[model samples]
Target: MPCELCNAFENEKSRIIYSDAHVFVVPILHPIKDGHVMIIPIRHAENMKDLTAEEARAFMTAANLAMDAVKKEYGVTPMFLVNGWEYRSQPHLHAHVLPSKTNLRGLYAASEGVVGKIEASVEELTITADRIRVHFSYES
Candidate 1:
């Protein structure tokens, strides 16, 4: 079976906000905050080490663009995070960009001991995606 993120890249249900040839940005199905988004490469790669130079460049560009969109749409600078291999929920490489006023340590502590998924409804995802999309300068 394909990785879930790979499936999401192809699935309309993913609520994609922005996408280019190399990467795509989508609202997290289980967001830490209102504007949390994930920057994922089109090609499957376990981590940064696995990414080719082109892929790395694309990922960084996508991350920066997504962060800018989040900031413009939410009026808050997003926190960029990447879980280490041991903590990752999926094997695919993805960067989390979350709009939060809290510091990293506070965010990490709050996330700890949290059980069960806080899945977002399709409606909520759609609305959030639309909001971020409005601020995205790229055509997708």
Candidate 2:
């Protein structure tokens, strides 16, 4: 099976809120909080260290844009998270952008179905994506 990120890119799904040449931002399906998103490199790199300088720059730019969008839409400062290759479910390089004060423990439990996480429905995802997209200004 293709990587989920790759599939999202290929399908041009509603989950994608922003994209430039090097990176794209998508609302996380199982969000740690409302307005949680992810910045994913266009290329399939397993780790940040694997990214080229240009790719790194693009990722940072996109991440910043995502933070700004989340802040504007959700009225909260955003926190970014990265997992090393060993901890990643997908080998593709991506960084998470979440609202500050998000309960990380809740997010973990939600992922495992031990507790309910805010899983955006398709319509809700589309609205959230549009909310962020309108605030995203960095396009190259």
Question: Can you give the TM-score per candidate against the true fold?
Answer: 0.84, 0.81
Off-target runs (Cα >4 Å) in candidate 1 are 84-86, 102-114
State the lDDT of candidate 1 residue by residue for 1-140, as single tens digits.
66998888878545788777878999988776888889988888888889888888888888989999999988888889864346679888899998868333334356677886567788978998999988888643
Index of the highest-lDDT prediction: 1
Candidate 2 local lDDT, 1-140, one digit each (tens): 77877666766465688887888999877665667788998888888999999999989998998999888887879888885345466778889888896555454554674544556678767787888888888656
Against the reference, the lDDT scores of all candidates come to 0.81, 0.79
* Candidate 1 deviation (Cα RMSD): 3.6
For every model shown, the clashing-pair count is 0, 0
| Predicted model with the maximum TM-score | 1
CA error at residue 36 for candidate 1, angstroms: 0.5
> What's the distance in Å from true for residue 123, model 2?
1.0
Question: Deviation in angstroms for 17 in model 1?
Answer: 1.2
